[model samples]
Target: MGRKRRLITDSFPKVKRRKGGPGPGKEDGAPEPGLRGEEPCEEILAAHLDETHLEILRQFDLNRHFGPCTGITRLQRWERAEQLGLEPPQEVLKVLWAHPEDPQYQCSLWHLYPI
Candidate 1:
């Protein structure tokens, strides 16, 4: 007769390790890197804006949208403009949104409107 085989069914507990830097409880109390404790500047650049342009900017701020026009894709920019009731020229809007870091988009703006 063949010998009977023994079955193993025991499981080991999992061990958890710390991830990344440190947890909240382990904080050293120094202000985290790149963080400042002062309020940001609130200066408005409305000196050159007419009532209509100012209203548009106010709507943009009321919607909590900031940053370059090109923060979103071209399609998204148009959709957002429509949603916000803004009708600025498409070329002007494109120039405003083009990423400053991208030389190609920046140069394209000059081509669109000669100085």
Candidate 2:
């Protein structure tokens, strides 16, 4: 008798996601408020977003978090978004450049105080 071959997919099963929401799970383009979490952020519910910002979001995260775009400062978000792939529009860069006071948001933002 021949041995049955084990496939790679057999080792990892895909997660079963709820049927709706803007997440990659069900919805295609934009996010709907998560059925489990708080109502989606105001920025998310707005019928229209700035065109350049819209382009940036579409490029930055296809599987975006359906929550507030807060916490991360505006500049940090744009800078980090570019690191992944796809540069945001030049207008975005210009706007961010005009405001240089943006503090970075990341795990390493705080250096330990010297003992």
How accurate locally, in lDDT, is each candidate? Answer: 0.45, 0.48
How many steric clashes between backbone atoms does each model show?
2, 0
Q: lDDT tens string, model 1, 1-115?
A: 5987655633555556577756655675656543554333332333333334434433443343433343343334545666777663454354435444544433322234434
TM-score top scorer: 2
In model 1, where do residues sit more than 4 Å from their true spots?
1-67, 90-115
Candidate 2: 10-residue stretch with minimal lDDT: 104-113
**Judged by lDDT against the true structure, how good is candidate 1?**
0.45
Candidate 2 Cα misplacement greater than 4 A, ranges: 1-68, 102-115
**lDDT digits (tens) for residues 6-104 of candidate 2:** 999999988776675444544475444564355556755552444454454444333243222345544565566577564645565664564455332
lDDT of 1 at 2: 100
Best by lDDT: 2
Give per-residue lDDT, candidate 2, residue 24: 56
**In model 2, what is the error at residue 47, expressed in angstroms?**
24
